[model samples]
Target chain A: MTRAVTIIGLLLTVIIGAGTYWVSHEVERLEKRYAGIQSEILAEQESIHVLQAEWSYLNNPERIERLSQEYLSLAQIDTLQMASIDDLPENADQHLYRLDKFGEAVAFLPVPRTRPGDLMPDEAAEAMIIDAPSVANAGGNQ
Target chain B: MSFMRFSYWLRGDRPELRPEQRERLAIETARNRIFITGAMFFVGFTWISYGLLDASVLRQGNEPAVASGTDTRELKTERADIVDRNGILLATDLPTNSLYADARVVKDPVESADLLLTALPDLDRDTLIRHLSSRKAFVWLRRNLTPEQQYQVNSLGIPGLNFQREERRVYPHGRLFAHTLGFTDIDNNGIAGVEREFDNELRINNGPLQLSLDTRVQYALEEEVQKAMETYSAAGAAGLVMDVYTGEVIGMTSLPDFDPHRPGQAPADARFNRTTLGVYEMGSVFKLFNTAIALETGSANLNSVFDATEPLRIARFSIRDYHAENRWLTVPEILVHSSNIGSARMAMAFGGETQQKYLKKLGMLEKPEIELPEVGGPLLPHPWREINTMTISYGHGIAVTPLQVVNGISTIVNGGIRRPSTIVKQDGAPAGERVFSRKTSDLMRRLMRLVVTDGSGKKAEVAGYFLGGKTGTSEKLVNGRYVKNARMSTFVAAFPMQDPKYVVLVTLDEPKGTKETYGFATAGWVSAPAVGKVVTRIAPLLGIEPANAKAPEIEQALQIELRKGERKLASF
Candidate 1:
């Protein structure tokens, strides 16, 4: 009888001790999971913040305006140069409207040539004499 | 003897081979066994119930955490960023930290307050100590601290000091778009402009906010107008550069403007947006529309001439120009001279009702409906009469906001399409409704070209750029008196009249003429030259190359042939 009583007391002690251990183990596991989740949340918050700043930096107005101005030349229209269909130049090869207003056209000037033998020709000398008065006048001739 | 035996067994130290002893022993053993079994059952039941209760409690507490673990669980989401047309940042939200305190756990309130105040001098130490020593569990110290402030505060490392996550709205461009973009309140609530209009959607959505404002164009326009204001010594000036075709407001400036960051520091006048709000009687500039109305309504044609031999005498008013040419001027010459007499004659021919219809059709004589909150309604003559028509023909008896004038002129030049102005850049934009016939638009464009070519708008002409515009100067009404010294000078212009692209308008209020200007404060003297300068600066930037080559065809079509007597007078 003494031995049986002793066995029951031993069983009670072991079961209670094991139950307490299980509860404590579960509580510790939950604590670790909570801390992990909290850290993850904090990291994500930081990432969002960084993204917002970068987004704004990418869309800086002043920088974009300066770049477009340098490259596109987004300028005000010059009203004086506004010409109609009837205003096309006579000597132009094409009659198309030119939006380019900054002297983009290639221009050619015609120069009359004089004969090289005119130095020896008598008739040419007389004609040159008429123009030579201007040259003489450059030397302060009366 | 048996009972005696039982009692003996119950308390027995020794007893052997007795039937009573055996029976007593059996009964005592059974009773002990029953008590042990019952106690074991009760203990097991109590422990089982306790375990179930604890599990349920944990499940209730953990349900919210698990349910919130799905997609709904978000630490923080990005806010919409505000950007200009060229992808420049105007406004953005940055992640910030706020300092809080667990007042109950604060070991030394006096020390904590002193340390916090040292980092943030704006904080009052006495107030901080009072708050920290309160019985409340929690108290806020400071919110939306900068990174440096956060680092400094964290280094203090006081017990019970905590940090809460927050966001701070930052405008890196500062005062550039103060009035237009507007600033948000302390709680990040948009109080004005596009921010206020679309606050709800932005709060819910996470993306970048786009605006139609081209910062480059804005800078040029603002700089030019501000310079004009300075050069002319004007009280204030407003300027706008808009794409005639798309009606996109490329740039707009209203000085003196305030900064969005520190709005409280700016004066009320500095906060006023003159371009969109301030309405003024824009004198002869309205003649452009009056003549167009007479021609469009079939009341008169380009060949129709007004009898301007004398100033028309009304009941209490007489209509005349600053320097009226008493001779009968042709329709084109009337516009060239900016003759108020000729304009009044044209308005009389069209009459009052017809004039109102045309003015309304031109988007004048009404309030300017823009996206901004600061829009001004037109100040129209209460008793609409024939006199009003005559006066309004030369821009009197009527007042309109500058924005309306620019938009109205854009309609006339942009193939007569009345495109409501927009500050938004859509990917695939649609065409605006046609306001005037293609014929009228073309003719009006020719007339406008003629204005700049040979008329009062000559000062507004930029070489190689077909700049067409009109000049207007109205006597400012101050304290119920017409102040001659104070006048509002305005110049409205458009370029490449053959194919209109942009419309740039400038206006100066109460401008004081300088010695260089010969003490003349008219639009032709002040605003016209400013328009010319702006065109010169912005044209090269917009890729419109200046061609000095003669446009013989346009010159022929737009050239003026003087009358026989005028030609004879030229020889004199």
Candidate 2:
């Protein structure tokens, strides 16, 4: 009887030990996966930060204005310049074509050298550049 | 028998009824007890393992026994509202009931379809009849039903009739900004416009989508262009307004526009985006760029002169001026006069390769980089033969979209920075790619002003604000040939030309001359006046003070010079 009791106790102990080992292994694997998720989440958060900064940098109004003038050399146009065909020059070649340096074909416009102050701030510029009229509401040419 | 032999014999099978038998019985009892106890422990362990698993899954909400069907997921998200930049609701998702049926449970298919058609007269009875009679387990009777229809359908309550929740995309503004804002399909998928471009990002996020476009600006721009279209009896018109600094597209409209809500009903041509998508041979507008390119490359200066006395003929093609002055014209005069011969001569002087390089740098020889799905690729001449160079100098042999011209002009007037145009409201974006030299850009700005004040674009001017632009008139190509009667009239202009903040481009396709415009459908007659009206309307809204109303000092530098004699260079 005593021997029978010993065998039964040994079997019980083996079962419990095996179950414990299996559970511990599973738990370890889960913890590793959890850690991986945490790191990835951190990386995404960093990327968002970068994107926000990039957006702000790209849409700066002062910078864009500076660049526009530096590149296109366009000034505010005048009413006379925007006249109708009735007022057009008599000759077709008088307003027909011009040469381009890059050698590609292009239409031509005479340069307007009107200064900055002549422009009136339009909704197109105010709404586009800063996107907020309340903060920067000056309408006259800068 | 000896005592040992007797014991051995007694221990044998014959001793079962003796003391040995009693001992064996006790051992068997203990072994049975152990076996029972082990079985109980094993069973208990198994039960505990199963219980733990059940608890784990239940805690994680992964219970397999619970059936989570379509109804649950359907109720999770309310549809998002779509609004214009000015807080005008263009589209909205409203809660509506939809009819569904379990075909297996339906007893009378014909009767049910008849009842459904009565409740929703828009539905075709024959089609519904077939669908309801199908062997399929489930079928959709109707989607996006009105409350009244839902009630009527439910009252009939044919056993299989079921009401399901669904969303419908609604466009409140109808057709105003249809082509630009775009519309969602039946499944609420954005197939075009700003919606398609930013589809994934906009799906779950319901925050206001701030666009660069202004509703008022859009209205004004559209109204003027439409007026021009009607007056000139034109085929179509397209106009765009852009912020010079940030490259934000404020108002873009194309005639023959379709209502996004009813895109399928509109003709394909009306749905086309002429501003950013349609590549046209933009006529004399090319000359502006050509002149800028020349000045930028040190091939010429404002004081330099080109001989326009005779047309330059090469092979079979002749490059001549429509209005031949037959005399020497200075660099500025060539642009103001729009002298094709003079410009071509200057191009030959600069050489083909140099001109190609500069135009590419100015974002003219490629597709304009804008945040839209309908961008047109630049129509460049292959092999770039010498004839191509000559024709290109006068806005022929190559084609580009209106947006490219705007960007090109922006590069010139915005001090040579080729900022990529954007539709989304970027409070502060990065400095886009630099495409030109500042000096070249400045020189180009002066030339553009000369055109508007003393050149063909005089009609595009706004008195109070110094406006400068170039007018272009190109014959539309039809079936591999240029149609003589049809022309695309275009104007590109900037305000306060000295330091440009905005560029406005207007185009009319195949317009017929009206008596008011002196039988002329040229850009100076059609597009120029349209831009003028736009500038007049939006000027007040944009906070630009009228010239007479503005404080005095601000207008000090605004001058329109008409010089008859040679003017000496005033050194900066």
Candidate 3:
């Protein structure tokens, strides 16, 4: 019994010593990783601060107004152009169809269309269908 | 003999100790060893316990004490940013490098100065060389260097040259909000405007200080004011757009403004904030207050008529109508004609004390409460005589800031509630003190609408926004005398008058009469048109839908009934 007790005590001390060593080594590795992550965070924060400032500078109202005047042909919305929902006609869907038909003519004028569907209005589509042979002949001659 | 004794002891031939004496001696030695080990362990345990306690609690308490000692100076150097109501950055601190040199350590002062001069051509080469050769321990080379310039200087690799990290206050919008946001000094200290007003809060808080200014509205107001200034060839102009219910100033602009980035280079006039800092006798616009007070105190009603046929003389001072009609005028007609005589009569009915009490209640008697630090107090007539009442009723002999004028009109139109104006964004509708009854306020709104539809402010009428306002034209007072033909024209208006939301005021100082104006430089010809244009542009931006003119509700609320013969006079 004495021998057994003595052996067990010796084994416990060895196991505890090895466990302490492993834990200390693991802690050192994690500490290094934590330091690296902290530096990365600091760097990212600095870049974000710079980008925010640049974004504001680029989006200044004066500069945007000037650029819009130079490049865009849009006009301010007039009070007469606005209509309430109740002002819509009962056949609103038919009016939308007419607008869609108008959209087709606009597509052929070298203006970029906003969407892929409804490339041409009904009238333009019909005209294109009737002149399809002549247009092919002209293309052949060119 | 001693050598013989040592050899005997070594050989174990000395006289032997008795068994009991030997055992006792061994016990004494063992006991001494055990006692020493115990004492050492006790000392080691005590030290370990003390160290654990210090690490756990004592150090944490000490840490703040130590950090605060070193951090107070650092905290003053670091500042927070400022943003508009919509989170647009107005002011921020940019990390920059300031170049310095140790003159005592510089190896070749001439060569170093020459290189630095090339990098910073604006610096004087001789001055830099002198600084480099001064033999001082440290010297300032240049401040706020650009990154590219810093790189070029660093590439030169001159000895004794170093860089100290510094923060430079940058105003990205530059001159757009110069007077409102103000500017800081080189040491990042607040010196003027909102910066000076909220300096401590800005220093302690790392978050952005959000002001109530909307940049879009600010830009629009500034654009219109600039156009008006150019058209009229005015000396200066100021404008304000405020929310009547919340008392939040959405936009405020003063012409001849400077760039906050380089305030030192701007002239003093450019740095002056006219909206809050300059006080003027805002002429007939004060009549709006007079009429409201008259109705509120039951001194006059819509049917009450005052004879404006001739000038009324009071104490050697005669008040005459600018647009005089040779007959009696009703209360609405008085405001519509902008009759100074009629307004004075209305004030007389209410008496001088009531007028003073109403003006004080409307916050016109004190400096306006805005976030700007340069607020001008109202200049009141000291004697409080009867003539002062008559003159002040038509907006003369008493001077108030443009901010106060707008705030007072807002109170009259915004259900008679007086809310102190602020430049800080508020979360919800703020409660205000009731200055006039709601019925009186509604009546005032109808009378203001009449002015736009039929009277002097006809030029201020937009197509569908239902704008209502009064115009004020006062000659600029110069050295105790009014300068004729050098007029300060002002227009104060509120939109969608049935339920007013915003009050806008535009003032032009000394607008020159142009050929286009038919040689008329009054508020109707100059400032009223500017107000109309501003309303047209900003109404849509603010998402306020235009109402149909013939809408039954609006027509009923703003309609004016005229007798058969009075219709002809109403058209005037």
Candidate 4:
């Protein structure tokens, strides 16, 4: 009985020892992974900071103005073209463009300096304006 | 064995026991001791193993996750960023590689120095050679190398040459934001502007400091002001844009300005901040205050008339209007025509004591308390005599900074509330001191609008912005005497006259009249056109949707009864 008890005890000890060793090794691996993730976050944050500074530099008014003048021919928004929402046509279904809306494409696009202070052209980068489906198609679907 | 035998003797065995029994007892005792020792070892191992299991699985992420998550805002750069009102970065700290050398490790100092010189042509050859040849363990070569230069140095693969990480205070927009952001020294110490004012607070490591300045407005103001300076070839020029309600300085420009990155190389004159530091008699812009005071004190109304028929001579000085109406001008006509004789008579209607009290309440008698270290106090007359009052009625004998003038103008137009001007962005409009009555403010707005519609400020009138201002031309005082030809021509304007939003001031020093101006270098010509251009450019950026200035409501609101059935002024 004594020999059997001793053998059982020794077996339990070996099992516990192996389990402890495995669990500790796994913990170390997880710790290393945690450290790796932290460093990755740090590196990404640093890169993002650099990108923000670059964005500010790229969005400089003078630089953008120069680039726009070289590329686009935009005109200044004239005071006559400005209209309030109250001035818009009441029929919402109608595709009615107010003076300000009418002025947007021609005013901010493709015009050189018309007067002394009529300069600042914007970088309206070839916008992707998807058109709506035709009225006939909508009527048929309904 | 001896120790075991002594313990056995201490146990004291019976004499009747046989040899076999004695051996059995000894064996049992040894077995008991072994059992106890094994049990202790097992318990200790169990405790340690349980601790490991609990920590890795159960208590995981308790300590380290807190550390990592909390430090997200602690960025890699040592210095915090500074942004404008729109979150545009005005100033920032960028990482850089500083070149140092491990002098003891260098193989051939001569070859390394030659390679270094080739890579960086600006470095001194003799100094480089001596530094690299030093027997010390470390040596200094240079600091804050650009990325391209760092790459070149790294490619050289020169032994002992190393790069230590550092940071540089970079102003990406250069001279555009020089006087606002200021610049840091080589060690990243704040030297001037907002940087100097918020030095300690910045070092505490928080988010970017957002200033009240709008970058787009600032760019417009600076470019327009710079263009005006170059066009007329003036001595110096300054411009300011302030929010009429909140007293927030949205844009300020003082040319010629210097690049913050190279402040040392810039001339002393370029480094001087003219908008805040330089004080000047703001010409006839003072009439806005004079008219406001007259109406507020009930001394004069819109219909009250004063004589502008001739230049009034008082105490060896002649107060002459630049473009004299040469008639008995009403109060509205006095401001509309910018008549000095009328303004002086109007100030005399209310005494100098009342003028002093009003000016004092407008925050003009002291230095403008702003977020910048470079600010000047107003230069007031010593004795505050009667003659001083007449000249000061039209902006002379008292010199106030451009900042004060803009702030005071905002007070006169913005419901008569005087809020101290600030550079730091505010969450909302703070409380203000009431300097004049609402009725008085409304009347002043009408007079200002009337000035733009049918007076000397016609050049400043945009189509729908309804800009109104006063034309000021003061002979600059030089060596205790006013020079005739050299004049400080200035125009102070407020836009959207019905509900005045912003006040803009443009002043040029000694602007010469070009052929375009027809030999007229007065404020009406030199600075008024710039004000109009600035309003045209900035109005859109500020999101101020233009309204019909000729609307009957606006016209009636801003129209005044100058003479009986005159119909004198145009639409507001």
Q: Best by DockQ, which number?
A: 4
**Residue B317 in model 3: lDDT:** 81
- Provide TM-scores for the models: 0.69, 0.65, 0.81, 0.83
Compose the digit string of candidate 2's lDDT tens values, residues A1-142: 9999999999999998999999999889976876676567655654553344344334333345468789988754443344334434567566556768988667767554343224346823653452212322222211
Listed models, DockQ each: 0.10, 0.03, 0.09, 0.12
> What TM-score does the first chain of candidate 3 have?
0.52
State residue B382's C-alpha deviation in candidate 2, in Å.
Answer: 1.4
lDDT of 2 by residue, B1-572 (tens): 57866875554423336787867866776787799999999999999988998898656665567444332212122334455455555455555678888888888989888777777889888888888888677788777877788888888878877888776665554566877877778887878887787777567755646787876677778878888888888898899888888888888899978878678888999989888889999988999888877877788876676777788899898888866778878887887888888888888888899888888877777778887788889888889989888889889988999988887887788877777888766676448666667877776776777787667877776766667888899899987699986999998888766667778888999988765555667787778878877887776656654443144543333333433323334511
Total clashes for model 4: 4
The most accurate candidate by TM-score is: 4
Off by over 4 Å in 2: A1-142, B1-92, B102-119, B125-137, B151-159, B204-208, B436-440, B549-572
Candidate 3 lDDT by residue in tens digits, A1-142 = 9999999999999998999999999989986876676667766776776677778888788899899889999766777776677655666444443224546522222333122112236633653542112444334322
Instruction: Please report the interface RMSD of model 4 to 1 decimal.
Output: 19.0
RMSD of 4: 12.1
Mind giving the per-residue lDDT tens digits that candidate 4 earns over B1-572?
Answer: 77776766766443358988887877887788799999999999999999999988888757575444553333546677899999998888888889999999998988989998889999998888899889777777888898899999999999898898888888877788888778889898999998889998777757888899999999999999889888888999999999998889999999899989889999999988888998998878999999999999999988776777789999898989866778777888888778889999999999999999999999889998789999988889999999999989999999999899999989999999999999889878889999999999899988888787677787887877778778888889898798987989899999888889999999999998775665667898889999999999999899886766446676777777666213234411
Q: Which model, 2 or 3, shows the larger lDDT?
A: 3
Tens digits of lDDT, candidate 1, B307-389: 67678899998988776788777777788888899899889987999888767876787777667777788889878988898
Model 3 misplacement above 4 A: A1-18, A93-142, B1-77, B562-572
Which residue runs does candidate 1 get wrong by more than 4 Å?
A1-142, B1-79, B100-114, B121-143, B158-161, B427-431, B479-481, B552-572
Clashing pairs in 3: A101-A121, A104-A120, A104-A121
